[model samples]
Target: MSFPKYPEYKDSGVEWLGEVPAHWGVKQLKYLVTCLDGQRIPLNGVERYSKQGSVPYWGANKIMDYVDEAIFDEELVLLGEDGAPFFDVGKPVAFHSSGPVWPNNHIHVLRPGDSAWVKSIVYGLNATNYIDFVEGSTRDKLTQSRMMSIPLAWPPHDERNHIDSFLDHETARIDALVEEQQRLIELLKEKRQAVISHAVTKGLDPDVPMKDSGVEWLGEVPAHWNVVKFKYLIAEFEQGWSPQCDGDQAETLDEWGVLKVGCVNYGVFDPTENKRLPDNLEPRPELSIRKDDLLISRANTRDLVGSAAHVPMDYPKLMASDKIFVVRLHQRICRSRYAVVYLFGKGVRHQIELQATGASSSMLNIGQGAIRELWIPLPPDSEQDRIVHELEKREADFAALEQETVRHMRILNERRSALISAAVTGKIDVRGWQADQQSRQSEILMAAETRATYG
Candidate 1:
């Protein structure tokens, strides 16, 4: 294909592309693309999966189901039309493929003159923060007018094809690496859970005989340990203050209050996201969290409801949310960390789930009455300390590995986006590329063969 030659310019905010050939046109997103609102297929109709026949139906979240027909089979650029997912510089959006390719109003499907050209634009959009302008509560909605007004950089057909092919290969490679790292992270998390579950329930020395702790949840513990109720060990189990009162009660120190259900501690004790209570509001002494105090979520998603965190003394004074159950242990009876870990452990979580109310929405309200009655297997003080020490050391090592993996994942993501940004913006030219094309074709063929044989 013949291409046009042009002059270069300065201070264009196109640093990633260095200098764009002047002949290449710059147009508003509206000029280069049209937002073809996706046809909405009923969720029920799409629920049935047809293996041999049917078009793939897409939903805002992903592929909701498969239908027998596709509305637009030709490839297109799909943007999530709805939801509150954080889609910025490195967060890749998953688009749906198949029959009508229906995207919720929460999603917008872009039809381009050339599919290859649009892929380049999509990559650019993904790499740069593309939709920072669209704002709303719940899911951010995109207005067609506003979307068209966004800026777009376009290159000639040949140059666009070259950039698309290069990015198609490089970004996939980076994504594969990121996926591998994510899998490793999942494995580490599983191992962490296993280690915690084993240590707390069985103790370090497995040679000890196992005996039932009477409490069904405490199925088995060290033969020498005593099964005691939680109430017998803690000074008090206080519920959170009701903020619905006075409307002002819900008001935080700042505009929003601290101690909302969302602010409750999960894996870590985070006080930053708390709502601010009114300045003149009297602080509830009962809600005050002390160092090593185990705060457990009393109500939330089922899996996360029983999650707990050990409050560090250095943390500023913050009250527990209504959805959280703050465990003020009698330091004289049990070491706080041990209790925190025990309550947060999978074993205890299962018990909490069994006793918790609310089927559609799981609620973990182990009031002082119920919490006091809940049974715990208590090993001798020395044994508890020993187990805690060994577990803490292993946990620390696991946490360090997790942090390292996360850091590397971040670097890989940054590299992947940079690679796409570079390829799309003409920072690194990939024009008339032959060898890479052959290599990529070979790789795709090999992948197809592998999938056919194994998957």
Candidate 2:
């Protein structure tokens, strides 16, 4: 759907606002809204924890927590002062909040003269390019004075209301579609995990005879399979060295680098998740990663503490960190891919989480002894190869569907941003627009019919 352009247009002096509707006026943001930055109060994590309650505590980009006290009770708009996604055009840096709320010092609060203008101002600010106003060497900072001088297209009251209403209805429709796609992606992930868990724990043959595995979590397994301890399958295991390194990744494969715990995060080796080794430090040639090396994280968050990945190829320039454990399986009995799939199953993951230990909730560590004692249900060598091949085929199919859904979401987001920018900048006239009530009612009826039929 396309919107009609204004009948007449005039050039605006501002470079970003090249032209506007003849009747529309252009003005700086400070003239239309009151700055409430002085009223904001900062809160540390400990302080916020102590005051946790119903009121939302806002930071530069989102709600950080809920606090007991309210700093402002009236409706207002908040813009990021720093640490926001300023460069991402599809994402918003300005948001509105109503009722009781506490905003931190990292956001600049704005009180528009008319409550009706709040949504319009937010839409305009999000559409505007902030490159000319934002400053800072490391982080983008929109200072109070710079934000005040930013330009906006000011339309008559009635026209502004029309744009806001149209945007509210249209964006809601797009958001719903985006939400559906997001939910589909999450469902696909859950299904993928389920398939892996079932394939690894219980063999692919559904009718195979089963027996109790004795362990409660590993309820039952194929009668032919054996439940063995992990230690029996390992040919070799060793922890890696950690050396102070540069923050950036190595530019070339020839440059020395040390792997971070995140290298095995997704159950696949990521060579790029490594820091460049300093030139002055001596390299550990013995610890260099090799092809078929199975790596696991010894220290990470609880969910990822025992994450393991099978190295598909060699990364000779990279050495593992102390937080990672390198292992080699007894190839005669177990394949690296088979071991990785088994470790990633829900049953094994439960054991890893239970054994992980740490003083802080954010980080946990698992010892080598704890890992070796974990139980594994083993099938014959030929069965392991067949399971791995079948899993790879299924994974590829799921990945293609996920990629298509993600592509659709990207297109929808681009359309949303373009519509908002065009309407707020007066590139499109919305005064004559009205909501299609009959069409919305038809959609509602169709949705109901779908549920009835599907259910």
Residue range 72-126, candidate 2, lDDT tens digits: 9887999999998888856889998899999999999999988878998999998
TM-score of 1: 0.71
Model 1 alpha-carbon miss at residue 356, Å = 6.0
Tens-digit lDDT string for candidate 1 (370-424): 4666677787777778877898898899989989999877877766665565545
Cα deviation of 41, candidate 2, in Å:
6.2
Q: What CA root-mean-square deviation does each model show from the true structure? A: 8.3, 6.1
Residue 61, candidate 1: alpha-carbon lDDT: 47
If scored against the real structure, what TM-score would every candidate get?
A: 0.71, 0.84
In model 2, where is the ten-residue run with the lowest total lDDT? 446-455
Output candidate 2 Cα RMSD. 6.1
